[model samples]
Target: MMIDFMTLRADFPLLQQKNRGKPLVYLDSGATNQKPQSVIDAMNQYYISDNANIHRGVYELSERATYQYEKVRHDIKEFINAAHTEEIIFTAGTTAGINLVAQSYGRSKLKVLDEIIVSAMEHHSNIVPWQLLAEQVGANLRVVPITDNGEMDLEAYEKLFTARTKIVAIAHASNALGTINPLKQMIQIAHAHNVPVLVDGAQAFPHMPVDVQDLDCDFYTFSSHKAYGPTGVGVLYGKQKLLEKMPPYQGGGDMIESVTFARTTYSKLPFKFEAGTPNISGVIGFGAAIRYLQQVGMQNIAVHEAELLAYATQQLVTIPGLKIIGTAAEKVGVISFVLDGVHPHDIGTILDDHGIAVRAGHHCAMPVMERFNVPATVRASFGLYNTHADIDALVSGLKDVLRLFK
Candidate 1:
């Protein structure tokens, strides 16, 4: 069944608002998606009915809240096809998830002189965490270069792998360039060297169907906000075996099996990593977001996004002074481009006047922009709710900008 975007758009209440006296055309789902009413209502219902601290209270509300919270873990486990619900750890966001791995897995497993590999197209969230870990542990950080076309240089990545490579951390999709990396092949290569690979799936998770078991990645991180869930909630999916071996990320109330001054033992699997009060309502909302995606179907979403990307690419190419940044064969629904003689900020402001929203800046992938030798580009990212008319509006907005600047 074909999903009607007009009907789908109605689910997101914010989409109905007017921007600058015109209907808003939101194209910035790459940064964070707009929430659906179902997700919002789910969160509100949790706060109203099941408001209590989880895993601690003995009351009925606490038990129900705990059940709902853990149910979201099961939902996430199924959403990513994780081997076990215990393998899913909820953190603040992708940033926190990566940091948890870096501090727990990287610090405990990595020795001095061990190497970690990352790609040139990684967001700062993926890069900085490893860098901090490397600096702290006296380890080395190796970078995989990218080609001129914004795709990861597979040959360069192969050359960087060595016996000392303990971990390979890279983004499944580049947030700045929108290039989908060859993650399956990359995982195969990493496993050949007996190294674990961590994928930052922040951008890819929203647009594609992800199976952690199929990919066989050691760890995968994604933000709920980017996937139409609430902020302050994200998921980290790790292989069960590796997660058992890793130490606790943070020491707090829930992560303890026994607590004493002489001997304090940590809990098993995911609970060890997730300490302190979690985002209970946000996780409930995340489940609703996943349900929303399931109802729409990921394959259907991917097709619609691909069509929008192709149409947007074609329309932008027709303009005289516009250039799309990433021209990779495999891409998501993002189109990053530079307009001649106009800064990306200027283009964004002018487009905002037309109620056409787009992101303008480095997109937290400064190394990518540096590699391309440009400061930043205007990024128009599509979501499941976006339609061909949104692309037309964006194209028309860009044309006006070009005419005004020319």
Candidate 2:
């Protein structure tokens, strides 16, 4: 069944709001998605009826809360097609998830002079953690260059892999360029070199179907907020063998089986990395978000987003002196473009006056912006609830801005 945009919009309260007597047009899902009522209600219901710290208490409320919290783990496992629930570890967000792997796996497995490969288009979250890990361990960070068309240089990437390459961490999709990387092929190449690959799925997860098993990536991370869930909750999915071999990411109450001044034994998989009290309600709300996506069907969502992107791109090209930053054959719904003689900040402010919200600036991808020789670009990203009308509104706003500037 085709997704009904009007019905979907009805589920999001923010879409109903008036901005300067105009309907709100949100085109910033790449930064963060607006929550649906189901997600909000799920969180509120949990807090109102089942608010309690999990795992330690014997009371009914605590037990129910613990069960609900753990249920999200199972939900995530199913969401990603992970082999086991134990492979799903909830963290603060994508940054925290990547850091957990770097501190645990990178510190233990990587040696001095070993190389970690990342792409030039990576977000700072993917780049900085590896940089810190390399600094700490005396490892080398190798960056794969991108084509002028904004896709990763896969040929160059293949040449960068060697016996010394211990890990390859790359984004599943370029948040700045909207270029979807060839992850399955990248995984195959990395595995041939016996290197484990970690994919930052923060952008891709929202727009496409991601099966870690199908991609065969060693590690996958994404933020719930990007997936229409609450903030402060994210997921890290790793192969059980790799996670078991890696050391614990943190030391705390739920992470330990027993503690002695002499020796401390850590808990098993998942918990060993999730040290403290997690975002219970946030995780539960994430489960609701996942459920919502499942009902909408990711395949349908992808098709809808692709149509919107093509429509937006076509109309955007009609505007005089506007150039899209990325022109990759494979892409998500994210459209980053620049207008001649206009700063992205000015474009963003002008659009805001029309009740159209879009992102401006480097998008936490300074290296990509530097590669393109631009300081920033205006980014408009689509979501499941978005329609062709939203793109029309954005194009109309852009035309007005162009007229004003000219």
Candidate 3:
């Protein structure tokens, strides 16, 4: 089915607003997506009608609230093609999820001199948790370096595993570069060496369809905000067997099945990981976001975004002194570039004057900037709602930047 991109753009209320007296051209979806009206209505409906805590109350309202919450969990299981609903663990966001695995599973299994493997392209969320874990347990971190084009070196990645390698944490797609890593092949290589892999899917989740069962990854995480849902909520999908063995990352509230002074028995698979009050409205709204994406279809989004990326790249590179970064073979709707004699921050400020919103920084992946020998790059990332006209505006705004700096 061909999606009407303009019709879908109207679904996002924020996109309709003017910025600096011009139409808002949003290109920073790699940071956070603009929520659709359905997501906003879903959250509002929860607060207006069903505003009770889940799992503890036995009354009618509480049961209704619990049903709305758990229904999203089930929807997420189907959305990602996970084997079981129990495998889905809710968290604050992708950062919290990585820290949970690093503390719960990494602390339990890793020993002194053990090794953790990660790529240089990882977000700080994926890198720092292991760094702290290694510092605590005397484990060492081995890095898989990227090539000049910002793609991971598969040969170097496979060679990093050895007798002491316990876990491999990497990104499914680079937020800074928009390069989609070969996750299935990477997972198979790690499994062959008796190592488990964790995938940071924050960037990939919004752009493509992911199947945890197909990839056979041990753990996968992504944020709801990046997928046109509410903020302050995300999901961590773990294998049932692995999660069953790992201890809870935090303790309190509904995570306990039974607790006494003498002995405390924790709850089952997912609940064991989720503690305290959650972002109830966010999860419910994420369900609506998932439904919206489903109606539009992921493959259709992919095709549309691919065209936008190509058009943006083709237009951006034609400008004199503008060099596109991360020219990988496979990429999503992200283009990072640098201009001669101009700072990225300056470029971003000038573009914003024309109502274009692009990110200007290392994008939470400083190592990527270091690898490219730049302090930062101007990144224009696309979403399903974006169009070729948005790219045209971006190019025009960039030309304005060049004229000002010249």
Best by TM-score: 3
Query: What value of lDDT does candidate 3 attain over all alpha carbons?
Result: 0.94
Candidate RMSDs in order: 0.8, 0.9, 0.7
In order, candidate lDDTs are 0.93, 0.93, 0.94
Summing lDDT over every window of 10 consecutive residues in candidate 3, give the lowest-scoring window. 269-278
For residues 70-118, could you state the per-residue lDDT of candidate 3 as single tens digits? Answer: 9999999999999999999999899999999999999999999999999
lDDT of 2 at 187: 94
If both were scored by lDDT, which would come out higher, candidate 1 or candidate 3? Answer: 3
Q: Model 1 reaches what TM-score against the true structure?
A: 0.99
lDDT of 1 at 2: 83
Task: Quote the lDDT for 235 in model 1.
Answer: 93
Task: Flag regions of model 3 displaced more than 4 Å.
Answer: none
What are the clash counts of all predictions, listed in order?
Answer: 0, 0, 0
Model 1 stretches astray by more than 4 angstroms: none
Better structure of 2 and 3 per lDDT: 3
